[model samples]
Target: INDTFGYQNYFGIIPIFDKENLLGTLVIELKSQQNDYNSRFPELLIEGKLKSDEDFRDYSFAFYKDNKLYSQSGKFTYPMVNTNEFEGVSNNVVFTSEDTNNVSYSHAIRKYDNSKLIVITKEKMPYVVRLATLSFFFLVFILFGIVIYILLWIAKNLADSNAGWFNINRYLMINANKILYKTRIQFSVVLSVVATLLIVGWTTFSYIKEEYLKQQKDSIREKIRKVQLSYEKQILNLGLRVDDTGELQFNQFADVNAAYLNLYDINGKLLLTSLRKMYDYGILEKRMGPVAFINLSKLQRSEFLNPSEKIGTFTYAAAYAPIRNAQNQTVAYIGLPYYANEADYEAKIGLFINTLINIYALVFVLIGVLAVFLANQITSPLTFIQENIKRTKLGQKNQPIVWHRQDEIGLLIKEYNKMIAALEVSATKLARSERESAWREMAKQVAHEIKNPLTPLK
Candidate 1:
């Protein structure tokens, strides 16, 4: 019916019945003037809902009718969906892409005819959005660090209190100050190194990505020139004009290269493309992009490099150039597209980060050991002096600290020794005064006794 009418159409049949008495059948026919049923099928299945849904913008849909991959909204969506994978599935299927990080969730509905209508949703996470997500995780890590610091602070306070746990925590919090100096040094060293590494790694990753894209653009321009020259040579040898060129030779060249090629006529109508799958899946339009057309045709430029060419949620660098005849007249335009593989780029970044973490781990261990050693060296002398001061007593010869070096600690020891010497002299004077007072008391007692006896005799 579609071939006869020159339009694609779908039909629905309903049996007419009156109170359980079957009658005739009712038929409904819908025709599509666009004549693109394959392209329109997925759109109709979605009911234009994805466009209005902000949350589903990063998602692309694919439909499988009767376990066959029928249509997809994006070229890269549902790459793992195949007839073989659905053979034994008695329920919904879940799959993920092998080439990328896209995951597909499948919902299968059994039809009346025993066939299945499978709706698959694939997440299309772009690299830019991934970076934003990484930033969020980085912020969470920082918050976690702050929480750890606060907990340590509270523990330090508890160590100083007269609580039952004080003895157990006291050894851990050896520093006398409010903040543990040793812990502060360790945290500072680690945090500083981590922050520095993060900043440098982020900047370097950006620079490397930019430079790699620049190189890809340059390579694309070169490929376009090389292919253009090869095409012109082939046409000249065959004595054919631009209108007479076929896609066979063009496709052969495209198969030999890494980048996809697009050929457009003088009026900007697409002639052929190396990537037919993109067009078949409705991922690309069959005409030159408007910006590239104007820049190449109207501006009369030999070449133009579009650094931010977009396809679905993917961005690539596209290079365009004009194909000219021997008479210097523009015959057609050529385009080459180069996609940036974020997975590979991120893998490289991960490897670099892992290496940095390993190295910093070693550095942290060394710093910790050095900090402990330095803290012990600083606190050992103060501990000794503290024990001596506790033992110091009046009326007894107190031991003086004998420090050899004339540093800060030596000065402290000198003052402490002087206090001990003065204490000993004061003790001697106190003992002699007590003895003299005792003698005076004895003399008074004797004189009183004698006076009392004489009074009694009288």
Candidate 2:
């Protein structure tokens, strides 16, 4: 007896034999309507998941049994067929497809029990999302700046009017105006370092992104050449030639590096492809790309590359080259479509930028500290000179500043010492002149008293 399972039924075939001769056969069939109950659990699970995430409200899914659709979540328009291909360790494959109506779908497939499950959502390109994100941030920054400007303007007007409610703002503005020169120097240093870091970081990120994309293009072109060589060898071994008179049947080739290939005839009509579902489901065209055709067939170029190819906003890189026969004649054109994963690229850039930010942040803190130290070092001598000038006197002995270095500060101290010396000399001259005048007045008083007494004696 052989037992087999079907989508909606179970079947058992029993063979009755008499001494090695089959006499009769008995078959039993049972309805497997238990799917109705089993299906609800997953539906409930999916419903709960969708409810939890509003972004996934438009998402849909389906289940397949041996390439047959078993159930689906609402009316899903994405055309899908099991390619019977096993993927990686997880037995899951991701697909992007577009329908006749140009509606794109981004979906994932998980295989289980000779069946596969598909979960799908509307397609969105990573670059588009990132651009939108940047636009949003820019708008937010602009809005905040406008709001701050308006507030400052209002504060200024209110302060001018001496409004009571704007006292704090007025006080703050006044204090800000009185910022110390040393503090200003420190702030300027920090701001300059920050600006320099931002500029350098942006340039570095751009260079890294450019180099990364260039490497991807180079790798795709190289892989396409290798595939072309292997394909030509296969054609020669199979004694096949690509000609318009007779349709050539080429064997499918698998790549260990997880690359896909497409073969086109001399006229640029797609003959065989590894990803057939892309065409069968209307996700891609059945004909070779026009740019590739012009380069490989018309221009007779050795190789061609479209660094950025878009299908419903999803961008990817594609490489193409001509395949030649032993007679050195163009036979078929080979294509390698490389879907560069932006996730890995983004992750790498994010990590790198984050590390750079962290390092710069630390540097910024250190720079700020150093700026404060330098500001103090530059301002300390001036502060000492100012204090000495405030305590200077005209009639008292004044001390002179003694500085060793012949820098600007030393020059200033030398001039201050000269002024102090001149002031001291003027004080000594005035004192000596006053002393002589007092002695003269005393002698005159004594002579007047003696003359009065002598006059009375005479």
Candidate 3:
């Protein structure tokens, strides 16, 4: 009997006494269902009973009864016996026989099952899952290191620039204060406070943004993982099979779909691809050479391991993961494109920075305006006082200071007027006394002249 369905159930066997004496014989009983009995029993019955020509011609088939061969084929054209008598026979028995032409033939005493063939193939090709995992992690570490190094370098450069600007501004402020003869200490203090606040605010904002980006990266990675996992599960569950030529192809299931699957060799040659050819084919192919392929592999492997590993700018969070082969090698990469929602946030930050700059500029402008106003207020009165003193020195005290307000300048002008008044009174008194003395001297001179004249007459 042929086990066409691969279910081990033994049917009645055919016994061949000779090449021409083929006869249906007793029912075959399997010793144990645990063994694959259907695989070997029919061949043994066909070849063993037909081994001798004389027995084949007579064609006497028997069931072994009580450890004795009992002829049952003599009375009936087809022999029939108890199914229990053949129980002790193992399923593995084989027989060799000759045909009418004395040609020997052998058939394999085994059951044919497609499932067994599939099992054998699966066993022969093992997937190295652990090695693939390790390789992915290693690439992830490398990519993460590169990102960290770039961030640190940027931060260092910014710090250096800020320090240089601070030093230059400080020096300029000192020199400007000296030339203007103005105390800029209060302005410097205010600027220092503003700078410190701005620095702190920027640093805090950066740190917060970095954390948010990290979280978003993790979320995107989780989404990709979920999508891939669902796709893989669907593929396995649906018993999908691909074409044999190792073509990179995608199968769409009831709820899952994948696209752009590609395969590359170790030398970075494109073996098979299912990518869309919408872009510039020549330029893309030329630019996607071995180096680009390797870099993409690394990035993909990193993303596969950490999934959160991001690529492209933070403003648009795009990332990739590796497609690994059974040999634990990165064969290809899969990428998910996403637009980060940070545009508004970035714009806000930019606006904030601009606002700060504007505030600083306004503060500087205000300081300059205040300095000029105060200087004018103080110097205008001093200039008026100085001009009045110059008039007094020139003996032109005709013009008096017109005091408009009762401030310090008004009081100075009042004291100056009182001094000028006292000087004028003293000058009048001295001039009168000098005139009297001159008149007395003149009178005495006249008397002397007269007396000289009288002496001449005597």
Candidate 4:
């Protein structure tokens, strides 16, 4: 029903007919509500869009009118879709793919076969900027683990240490030769060592990284100053009363692609510069006057993105120097600010740091696995020695302690076994001597009784 004439009613006329005879005429009229239902059709199609995650609920919809986009809201920036990916899609489909912008996005798309339209929603989780590094938080968690392990180790050995008024124990470590596993400390000791290594290794790496970055920043600032001073020599001849052409030529003197370049007169009024890019960044508002130059402190981790080249937040060293003439009077300030790095440097640095953290984690895990086998070798013999000593003290007959090693623990068991043998031999000799003395006394008594009886008979 084409309402080509912009009419409010759609009229249909039909002729009532009998078999081969016309009888009467019938007519029907339908009113249109000023295309309200048609206008609301787009909203109806977006019901699924609103029923998504709360984070993407607002302004995340795109409307397509059969193979072409008609309207879009929010940041649904994917384009150049291969229709083949949606060939078999009859119902709503959600997927993740890189957009034309080369940013990975989670997309939710639905096709309306009846109207030949589609609605798509997209979200990019990787683009989020965290306030702090997750690696640092992970380091904190590792430190907590170290504390727990050490506390447990200390608790288990507290009574032993107290017995000898805090006597030091043997070194807790695993002794492994190149080709074979040999010996190790108790299980608790190995756990404590692993935790300690993680904390110390991570903390040292973090400190080194911070220092390296600081040195890099300083080197960059020094280089920027060197170049600015070189240009300042040329500005000395111009007397700071330069025209638009001179100001632009001055801006071109900088080597790197700087974030901003502008000239200000002695009174701090804005002069000639890039009109299209002028004042877009709020940096120029406060950096116009002499006070700004005096109070010029360095900015920390300022974020800058170059449209021509994808460069992430670069740590920049900005400098503004006043141009003077022969009289040494203040004239104008030449501001040179720039940064240099290859594409994707930020992502690379992040990857490198995370890789280091992961390596540390993996090494700790390997050490933990090795600790189990090594603990048995060290603790088992020590347990045997302890049991043998207890039995010997209780006067119970016991076989010799069994151990095969040339290590300190093996030597200790050997010495204890020798001492037990020496004590047993001494006890046997003393008992024999006492028995001999008793026999001699009995023989003397018998001889005395027989001699007295013979004397009485004579």
lDDT of 4 by residue, 1-458 (tens): 65222225778999999987989888898876431222222221235655343344433555554455454556555344435433325565645454556655555656645334445555454422221245445556877999999887677776564543243343242222322222335446666876787788778768866666666556545554555456556667554435766766655654233334555664556664432242554433533534344443222111121212211342433445555555755556555443333212454466667766665565554565678667776667777777888788423355677678888987998888888887677767777888999999999999999777865567
Clash number for every model?
A: 0, 0, 2, 0
Q: Residue 377 of candidate 1: its Cα lDDT?
A: 74
Ranking by TM-score: 2, 1, 4, 3
For candidate 3, the C-alpha RMSD (Å) to the true structure equals 34.9
Give me the candidate number with maximum lDDT. 2
**Residue pairs that clash (backbone atoms under 3 angstroms), model 2:** none
TM-score of each: 0.53, 0.59, 0.30, 0.42
Q: Which candidate, 1 or 2, would have the higher lDDT against the true structure?
A: 2
If ranked by lDDT, best first, what sequence of candidates would result? 2, 1, 4, 3
Candidate 1 residue runs with Cα over 4 Å from true position = 1-245, 354-370, 425-458
Q: Which pairs, if any, clash in model 4? A: none
- Tens digits of per-residue lDDT for model 2 on 1-458? 12323245667899999999999999998765432233222122234634445344457766665566556654455345555532212456666555435545555665544544544545544554455455545555766999999899676767775565557677779999999989998988888988998899899989998898777777777788788787778777764543542222443354343566777878888877656557776878888889889887788899999977777776777889888888988888888876544534666787677566556655665687799999999999989999999999889989998789999999999999999999999999999999999999999999999777865567
lDDT of 4: 0.53
The Cα local distance difference test for each model comes to 0.66, 0.70, 0.47, 0.53
lDDT of 3 by residue, 332-379 (tens): 444443433354356556655655454544454455456667666666
Q: Which residue pairs overlap in candidate 3's backbone?
A: 17-50, 300-322
